[model samples]
Target chain A: MPNTLILSIDAMGGDHGPSVVIPAVDIAARQLGDVRFLLHGDQAQIEAELAKAPAARAASEIRHADKAIAMDEKPAQAMRRGKGSSVWNAVEAVKDGQAAAAVSAGNTGALMAISMLVLRMAEGIKRPAIVASWPTMNGISAVLDVGANVESDAEQLVEFAIMGAAFHHAVHGSTKPTVGLLNVGSEEQKGHEEVREAHALLRANSFDFDYRGFVEGNDIAKGTVDVIVTDGFTGNVALKTAEGLARFFGNELRATFKSGPLAMLGAVFASGALGAMRKRMDPGAVNGGPLLGLNGIVVKSHGGADAPGYAAAIRVAADLARSDFTAEIDRNIRRLGAVVSESAASPAEGAAE
Target chain B: MPNTLILSIDAMGGDHGPSVVIPAVDIAARQLGDVRFLLHGDQAQIEAELAKAPAARAASEIRHADKAIAMDEKPAQAMRRGKGSSVWNAVEAVKDGQAAAAVSAGNTGALMAISMLVLRMAEGIKRPAIVASWPTMNGISAVLDVGANVESDAEQLVEFAIMGAAFHHAVHGSTKPTVGLLNVGSEEQKGHEEVREAHALLRANSFDFDYRGFVEGNDIAKGTVDVIVTDGFTGNVALKTAEGLARFFGNELRATFKSGPLAMLGAVFASGALGAMRKRMDPGAVNGGPLLGLNGIVVKSHGGADAPGYAAAIRVAADLARSDFTAEIDRNIRRLGAVVSESAASPAEGAAE
Candidate 1:
C-alpha cells in the first residue's frame, strides 16, 4: 500500500456483491499494474471470491465491514446510521489516505451521502456533481451534474463547466476541453432564465476550459462539445432519455430482424455487422459514472453492471487516482473566483482549501 | 371540396416552402383518398409546384398571400406585422371553417402565435400545449407541453394530462390513455414541487385518462404510459435529447458496418433488415406534432422534414379533423376544473364555450 496505487472497494455493494467486485478488481489489477485493492465487506465471502483470482488475492487485503447499505435506503438514513458500513468504510479509506480513490455499486443517494460525509466537497464547490461518460459519435463526452443537485442557478452551472472539463481532462487527457451549457436551444430567447444567464456569463468570461457558448439537446450526441454543463434536473433527464432511446433503438433493431422468415434470413447473413453494432453501443461497454467535485475521487459503477462493467468503473477510479485530478480541480476552482467566493464562508470550504 | 376533408396548408412556412408543401399535399391526397387542400402562399410559387403533382392540383385551391413569415421571426413580431402572410391565412382558413384543421412546417413560435390569434384556445384550457408522438419500445406514446409553455404549475400539468390523453385517444383510438407526470425519479419526492403536486392531483382525482403516478425520463421511451405530462422546458429537452440519441444510434450503426470488409459484406446481406429498422424508427415515418388545446386542430411538421415527413404531418391533421378531437379536449378540460378556473377569464375561453 505504501508504494502501490490503492483503491478501496465496497465489496458488499451491488447486486452480485463479492462475486462481481472480486472479478472486476482482478481485471482492473491485471490491466493497471501495481494497484492494490482494499476490499471492505464480509471477510469470509470476499476471501472465497478472492481465492479464484490469485493475482487479486496477492495484491489485495480485506477490511471487514459489519453492515451493507440497502439499495433502497434513504440518503438521510444512510448518513445517520451508516457508520462502519461497507460503503462508509470504503469512502473512509480514501479520507484516511489508505486508498487514493473509492469505487462502489451501492445506492447512489447512499453512496453520495457517505462520500460527502467522509471525503467532503472540494474547496469552493457549492455541491458535488455526478458526471457520466456519454458515448457520442466522436468517442465520449462528459456530462454533469447527472443528479447531484436537484436544481442549479447561473453560478452553479458555471461551476459545473469547470468541474466537467476537469473530469474530461483527467480521464481523456484532453487539455482545453470544449465545454457547452446544455440548453433547449442555442437561441438567446430560448431556455430557462438561469440557463440564459449561465450562457451569458460563460461567454463573457474565460475559464481554464474552452467555453463553447450554448448548445442544444441535439448537439449532445453530435459530440458538439467535450463537456456538457447543465442543472442536475435537465442533465439527469437528458442522460436517462438518451439511455431509454438507445435501448429502444437496440430493441427495435432486434425485433425487426425477428419479425419474419425473410428478416431472420437477412439476420443470419448480416450477423457480424449487427453484432458489431450491438457491441459498439452496449451500455455495459461503458458503465461507470465518476462522482466528481469531491475532495477525493469516487467511481460509481452501475448496480446491475457485470464483471467487465464493474472493471470499467474500477479502472476509472484508478485513472483518476493516477492523474493530478484533485489538484487540478482545486486550481480550476481558484481560477473561477466568483463561484467559490459566493460559498466561500463554509467550514468545508476552508478545510478543503 | 364539398364532400372531401379539407386541410389548410401554410405553403410559405418551412425551409423549402412551396417545394415541400405542394409535394406533401400531393402525397397526402393520394394517401387519404378523399382530401382537399387549401394552399396559402405566393400564388406564382404555389402554381409552379402544383403543376408537378396533378393529384394536388386537382384536389387543391391556391390562395395568394402577400407576405411569407420568415422562419426566424419572433412570435410576437410575426403576430404584430404578419397579417395576410401564408401562415396567417392558413390559420384563418381554420377560423373561417373552410378547413377542419391546419398543417404547417414553419417557425414553431410563429405558427403557435398565428394559430392562437386566429383559432384561439379551447374552452377552459389555460394555455395550449404542443403534443407530439414519442416513439417508444412498446408503441408510440404522446408527450405534451413540448416547448409550448416554458414553465407550468401543477394545474397546467393536470391540463396537459387531459390534453395529452385526449390527443392520444383521437390519434391512436385508445379509450383510456394512461397518463404519467414526468419526473426525475419514480419516487414521490423526486421532481419539481409542481410535478409532485400534479402527481397527487392526478392520482387523487379520476379523469378520462388512466392516471398512473410519477415516472422518470427513462419511462418516456419505455411506453410505460400512453401520455407523459411535463412542463415545456423539461419535455422539450427530453424530446430533443431522444432525437439526438436516435440519430446518434443510426449514425453509429452505419459507421460500424462501414468499418471493415467483413462488416460491410454483412451489411449488404442484412440490408433488408437494416432498412426496415431505419424505416420503422425514422422520425419522418411519424412526423406530426398536434398543437393541442386550440379550438381548431393545428399540426406542425418538422421544418426540415422532407416529402414523406410533411405528408405524414398533413395526414395527422386529416386524422384529427376527421375525429372529434376538439370536443374531447373541451370535455376533458371541463373535468379538470382547477386548471381552467385559474385562467378561465381569457377571451378564447369565452369564444370556445
Candidate 2:
C-alpha cells in the first residue's frame, strides 16, 4: 500500500476562506492520488463547503478552530493572540506529525510568524524565504526570497539559493539544477558588495546546484537558470512587476483587437489562437509556490486566487509533502553549512547599520 | 525663424556608429522642424554617412574628435582617457552653450561619467538619474534613478521625484504629475527605514509633483502615478525586469498560436489585430527617455537601437532642449531642497556600517 501524504489546510485564511479551500482540496485530491487532509477552521462552514466537494469531504477530517487570524494583524499580534486559530492549528498539525505539510493563502506576516513559531526553523537554515513560481519562455523557474526577509546579507542570500535549489529538485525532478544570483548587471563588478560576496561564495562553495554566476532581470523570464536567488525586497518587486507587465501586455493586445471592425473580424478568426495564449498565461495555472527553507512544506496561493488557482497551490503542497522534500533540504542545508563556514562574517558585512 | 534647438550628437557612439546616428539625425531634423546638430566624431566618417542623408547634411555641422570610448570601458577609464572623445566633446558642446542638449548611444556608465564631468551636477541635486519613459495602460509615465547610483538615501530619492516630475511636465505637459515611491509593499510599516523616511519626507515636502505615497511594482504598469521614484538599484532592476517580462510574454503568446493547425488558422484570421498589437508594443515606438537631474539635458538611446530608435532619442533631446526642461528641473530641485531640510540626518539613518 502506498503511504498516505496528509496536508493540513487553513480553511479560514484566504479572502474567500472555506468556499475556495474546500473545492481546491477536492481538485488537489483528484489530481494527486493517495492523499488525505486535516482541515482546520470553523467546522460548520467547512462542512457546508465540503458537502459541495464530495471527494474532499471523504478525504478530509475536519477539526474546529474557535478563531481565525485577521489579515491585517502583524506578526507580533499573531504570536500574541493567534493560538488555536486556523493557520496556527494547521501549522501545529504539521509539527505534531498529524499532517505532512501546511498550506495557507492567508496573511503572509501572520502565516510566516505562526509557522516559524510552531514548526521551528530547519536546523541549519537561518531564515526561510517565500518562493515564487515564475513563468518562463521555456518552462517555469522558481524565484525565492520574495518577501520573507526585507533585507538579506550574503549568507542569507546563499542560503536562499540552497533552499531554492533543493525545492526545485523536489518539485521539478532536476538532478543538477542550475542556479544564478539575480543582479542589476551580469558583470562581476556590478551590484552591491554583498551581491558580489554572494556570487563569489556560491561559485567557490561547491554548492548543490550548478551555479551559473550572475544573471540580470531579463534572465528571470528567459529561464536562464532553474533557480534565481536574491534578497526578498528585490525579488518581491520583480515578481509583482512581471505579473503586472504580463497583464498589461494582454490588456493592451485585446484593446488593439477591439479598436475597429476589421480588427474584430480578425479576432473571430483568431479566437482559437488567442484562446490558447490566454490559457497559457492564466495565473491559475501557476498560482502555487512553495515557501522553501522551512521545517515543513508550506505553499502560498495568491490572495485573490479562486478555487482553480487555490487548487494549484494545494497540488504543490501535496506533491512536496509526498516526496522526501523535507529530509532532502535538511541534508543539503547541513552540507551547505559545513562548506561555507564563513556564514558568521557575512551577516556583519551585509548589514546596513 | 523659429528658434533652432541645437543638439550635440556623439556620432561615434553605439554599435553601428555613424551609419545609425547620421540617418537618425536626419529623421529627427524632419520630425522636428526647428532643429540643428553639432555632430562630434571623425569628420571623414561622419561626412560619408551624412552624404546618404541630404537633409541631415543640410542641418548638421561636423566637429571632428580624435578619440572614441569603447562600449566595455568603465567610468573611471573614461574620466582618464575619454577627454576630446566623441562623447566627451559632445557633452562639452552642451557645457559651452553651443547646444542645448547632448544625445548619445554610447556606454551608459561612460556617458553618465563624461556628462557629469563636463555638465556638472545641477544645483541642489547630489546625483543625476536616468529616466525611462514607460508605456502604461493610459499613457507614458516616467520612472527614474534607473542606474545612476546603486544606492541612494532619502534625499536623493526625493530629488529623483522632483526631477522625474519636471521631465513628465516638460514632455507630457502635465502641470502636476503624480509621483509614487516604488516599494515592496504599499502599507505604511513595510520596506526599509530609508524608504519610510523618504515616504515621510515626500508627504511632508511641498513637492511640485502630487505625491501618491507608496506603490508596489504592479502599480507601475497600472499607471497609478505619472512619476515613479526609487533608489537606482531597485529602479534599474524593475525597469529591466518589466522589459524582459514583456518580451517573454510576446514570445510565449506567439508559440501558443503556432502550436497546431487549428491555432495556425486562427492566427491567420487574427493577423490584422495581431499586427496592430505588434505595432503598439514595438520598442522603437518609445525609444528615448531623458537622463534627468543634470546641468543640461542628455538623452541615452538603446545601445542596439536601429536608425528609427536612434531618431526617437534625438527627437527627445530636441524636445527637452526647447521645452526649458533643465530650468524647470533646476527650479523644482531648488524648491525641493528648501522643503526637505533634513538631508543631513538621512544617510546616517540608512547606512549599515
Residue B124 lDDT in candidate 2: 82
Candidate 1 lDDT (Cα, 0 to 1) = 0.82
Candidate 1, residue A327: Cα displacement in angstroms equals 2.2
Best candidate, DockQ-wise? 2
Q: List the candidate 2 regions with Cα displacement exceeding 4 Å.
A: A282-285, A339-353, B282-285, B340-353
Off by over 4 Å in 1: A1-3, A260-262, A282-285, A339-353, B1-4, B283-285, B338-353
lDDT of every predicted structure (CA atoms): 0.82, 0.81
Q: How many times do residue backbones clash in model 1?
A: 0
Q: Residue B257 in candidate 1 has what lDDT?
A: 69
lDDT of 1 by residue, B1-353 (tens): 47689889999888999998888888888899888889999999999998899989999999999999998988889999989998899989999999889998889988998889888887877888898788777688898888888778887899899888888887877888998888778877676667766776676556888898888788887889999988887788777777777777778777876877766665666667777677666433578998888888899998988988899888888878887777777776676675445544322111000
lDDT tens digits by residue: candidate 1, A83-198: 99999999999999889999999999999989998888888888888887887777788989888877788778888888888888878778789998876667666677777767
